[model samples]
Structure formats: C-alpha cells, structure tokens
Target: MELGIFLLAAQFEAGDQGAVLTAALDAGCAAEVAGFGEAWIAEHHFVPYGVCPSAVTFAAMLLGRTDRLRVGTAISVLPNTHPVLLGEQTALLDQLSHGRFTLGIGRGGPWVDLEVFGGGLERYEEEGWAESVDLLMRWLTRRRVAADGPQYHFREVPVVPRPLTRPHPPVIVACTTPASAALAARQGLPMLLGMHADDTEKAEMIRTYDAAARACGRDPRGVPHAAAAVALVADSRTEAVRELRTALPKWLGLGLPAHQTLDGHPRTMRDPRTYTDYLCSIHPIGTPKECIARLRRTAEATGITRQLLFVEGAGTRERTLENIHRLGKEVLPHLQAD
Candidate 1:
C-alpha cells in the first residue's frame, strides 16, 4: 500500500496565514523524512477551507523542498483554467521533478471562483469540463494538440518540453459523484476518492467506475485508485477522537460558510460538530493498532491500495506532525505488510 499525506493548508484560527502554509510545506518534507511515498496538496479560492489558491504551484514548491516524496495536486480545478496553460505547467513540473508529479483534475463546484476566474457558472454545469479534460489529455499524450469545442477553439500547437514520464505523468480524477466516476473511467484514468465518503460509498463508486471502464474497453483492475481519509494517532481512541472533535469542528466552522455560489444557487454547508462526529466514527482516529485495522478494512472493502490521509484534523501543526510520524512509523509497516 502507498501512504501519503493530504495537505489542505487550512486556517483553523483567525491569524497567521503564512504559518499555516509553512506548516503544510513542513509536513510535506516530514512525509519524506518519515518514509512516506507522496504528499497531495488541495486548492481552494477565497475560503479558509484551504488557503492555498493553486495546488500545482504549491506542489512545485514542495517538490523543490523534498528529494524522494512525490507531490501532486489533490485537484486543480479544470473549468477555471485554460487546459493548454495547465498542460504546459504540468509538463514542466513533471520534467523538472523527474516524473514525480501527478496532475489530479476535477470539475470544481459552482462556486464564486468561476465568476472570479471568468469561467462563469455555465462552464461548471455544461460541456466545458469534458472538453477541457480532453484537450489536456491530448496535450499530455501527443506531440501537438488542437481544440474545437463549445468551451475552447484553437489552432494546433506543438507541445513543448513534453512530460518526462512515458506517455505522460500520472493523471487522477477527483470523483465525488457517479457521473464524475464514469468520466474518469471512460478516460481510463484512476480516481481519487474523498475523505467524506465511507467504505460502502467508495466501493460503490469503484463499481460504477469499473463498469464504465469495461464499457469503454479499459481494464479497471490495473488502475491504482486512491482513497482519502482523516487520520490521527494517539495513546488511545478517546484521546485521538477528543482532539479531532474539538479542533476539526473549529476549522470546519470557520471555513465551510465562506463558500459562495456563482449562480445564486442555494448551498447548505454541513454542520461542523455533526460532521466531525461522523468523521471520527468512520475514519482512522485512534491508536496505531486501531488505525491499521481501519485502513486495512477500508482497503479490503474498496480494493484501494493508495491511502491519502488528512493529517490536520488535530488542527495544530505540532499534533499534525506527530500524527504523520506515528502513522509512518507505527501504522504504515503493518498495512504495507498486508
């Protein structure tokens, strides 16, 4: 099994944005030192849910800071950016990092981000996502690319500094719904399942994706799908859960209500306390032994080998780092042995 940290760079308090960012970067370096294989960065705009506005840019900085740890965007919102420009950046990062970059793409929500980026709500709701992803795939896989779609119409241009990895660097799709899972399957790309989902939900999504991949003549068994889950390790389950319940709710409370929809759509944010309770029940928040059991069960149920753990549920940088190190030293070996 491959273990990695998922860095949201969330601001749990009302101060020091730079400190939050520094902590995220420090965690990425710690992942490498602790013998983890990868670190994924999240992107959010105008929300403390994730202060990092550009996951790819953050990934580049972390790549520069670490020697062996692979860095990837948990997702870079596809509809809000030009595919060609993103492809160019992805290619450069992959080449420079010696094929250690993974580009995870997603159709972000109908948020104010589309309006701010001039993409509009229509782009988020319509064919823009498929068109953009298609163009991006062409850019990564071919020597030159062109596009003529409702969202993009362009002349053929040569791909400069092609990705260093054969074919291209790994591309994973963030799947939150059946449609998204199908989209990834049709493209024969792996899926990145979110932390909010349970094993049953994730297994169903994998089934949806697998059936779609088969329909498209793509084998799904070989695809290395990744699952994200909240993680914290302490002396006992009580201590771990108590710490997360207190800190995660505060982070969620400060961050969730900040999202604004682009088209005046009604958006109901999850209740922070309730959501925190749900996460503690479903995720790996306990001693190392209990964490290992939870993760192994999730993997066995979902057939997911890649684990992307959200280590910041404890809120503070010190506790987050301790969780990461404990996970790497105590839990990872047993899970990997399985």
Candidate 2:
C-alpha cells in the first residue's frame, strides 16, 4: 500500500496554477511525513496540461523538501531521451536524495505521446522493445559503451557520476499487456498496472512475469514487483468523481505530435477535449473510502506489492490533496501487511 503521486493537473478550477503546483508538491511532502513509502513524477509534453514533463527535475525538487520518501518517475519516455543523459540525470538525483531515487519506464502505447519521437508502437514489437531496453540498461550501467542499433548508435563513452545507489537505483516498468508484463519479468523489473482492470488479468500478468523471470535464470523472489494506476480519492464517491470531471477536457484533448511525446498514448492537450472522456474508461476514480476498498481488493486479488497512485491535473487541487493525505492516513493502513 505504498503511495506515489502521478504529475497531472486535472483540477485547474480548484485554484490558480501556482497554488496547484504547490498543492501537488505539498502533498508529496505530506505523504512522506505521513509515513508513505515513495513518491513519483511523470513526463508529458506539448501542452499546459502537464507542466512537469521533466520528472528527473521534479524528483530533484522534491528530494530536499522531504525525508525518507523514495522519489522517482512514473515513467520516463526512454526512446526519445538519450539513455546516458537519462542515467546521469536520475543518478544525480539519486545521489542528492541519498539513494532515494528509482526509475520508471513506459513505452506508452498511445499515439500522441508516441509520434513526438521517430520511434512508435511498432518499434516496441517482438525484439524491438527488448533490444531498446537492453541498450538502455547497457548505457546506464557500463562505463564505456560501443553499441549501434536501428534506432540508436553510440561509441565508446562512459556516463559520469553513475548512481549513488549500488548497481543503479531500482527500475520499474509499466506493464499491462500480457507480453509486456512478461517482458518486464524477463528484464527482472517491477511493473505498474491499471487499478480498475480485472484482478484476474493482473494476476495473469504476474504469473507471466514470474515465468519470464524463471526463464531468464533469475529467481522470482529476487525481483521486486509493483503496479501503478490512475486514481482521485476523496471523502465520498460523488466528490471524487466531481473533482475528476474538472480535468476531463484536457485528458480528452490529448493526441498530437509534440516534442516530448514518447508513447503512442493519446496526448492530453494535442487533441480535442473529448479525449479525456476516453481516458476515464481506464483510470480508477472514487471517494477515499470506496477507492481504498477497491484498492485492497486489487491487492488481494493481484498480489501486487505496491500500488502507484497517479493523482494529477484530473481533479481539484484541494480535493486531490485531501484524498492523498486521507489515503495515506486511513486508506493505506487498511491495505497493510497482516
């Protein structure tokens, strides 16, 4: 029942932009103070919908503001970013945070985020994604790399500073599809999954991951596993959905070619506002009590070790913060280890 924040602005009406950013950051600090285990940021571009696209920067900002909360990116668009630079930025943050930073990666299947870079969903097929991730790992860990690929090329070069955490900080991947989860298992990274989906599907994904890890000659217990899903919590279900609707237009509007789009997932600002409605079909939204209950069910059914909460521009700032704090205090306790 670890708590994590997803950077989004679904509730522009709750307050002025400055206040909203403060609320989000404050929530992170509060979550840490409340004994929540970790906090994460997201990367999005080409629209005012997501102001914090540089998650590495955001993580750095939060490190000094809180103690003990493991900060990380919900996912960094790896294809468009230079792996060496990505490693350097996150590692530096890790050092600054006293080894409290982790890395999250998502090759978003949505089109809007995908088109920003030359690579797209097709590049993630079969050997494509595995190869790309493999290269990324090599660049992150090796002092000198001499590698070439269909999408990237590099000569002998060592990325500096490395990471304060030994063997690099823990890596998490967003894995929903069966194949994708299996891929994560193969790579031995934890995963993030949607909260509203059937637990049966999520369990199947975990099974696939276990099998993949076994095939890779690694013990399944040696790896960490996690799932991240979108959520907006409040005191009542009605209030939760009420706040969620505020950002629907922006979420629905995503789907455009932008400089930071990495995954093919629809963009929040590039397309018509109707796109947010489309996204609602996938995320988990409800009051604190109800959301907590549902999350517990997910944990029991899927056996997911951690739940990544993506609370972004989707709901009013006040309500979003309230739910986050309440969730840490009241909700998480219900989902704790027996």
Worst window of 10 by summed lDDT in candidate 2: 252-261
Misplaced by over 4 Å in model 1 are none
Error of 1 at 219 (Å): 1.1
The TM-score leader among the candidates is: 1
Tens digit per residue, CA lDDT, model 1, 1-338: 88899999989998899999999999999999888999999999999988999999999999999899999999999888998899999999999999999999988898999989998765676367777878899899999888888888889889997998987889999999988898898888999999999999999999999999999999888799999999999999999989988898888988888888886766898999999999999888899999999998898899998999999888889988998899999998887787
Model 1 steric clash pairs: none
Candidates in order, TM-scores: namely 0.98, 0.80
**lDDT by residue (tens digit), candidate 2, 1-338:** 55565555333453375665677787788778656788877666655555566777777878889878888786777755666677778777877888898888877544444566666665556566777777767756667776677766667777677777767677888776877787787777788775435577788888888888888897777355676666766566565565556655544444233334344343444343444443344445666667766777777787875777776634455656665776677667766653
Q: In terms of TM-score, how similar is model 2 to the real structure? A: 0.80
Cα deviation in Å at residue 59, candidate 2? 1.3
| Model 2 per-residue lDDT at 119 | 65
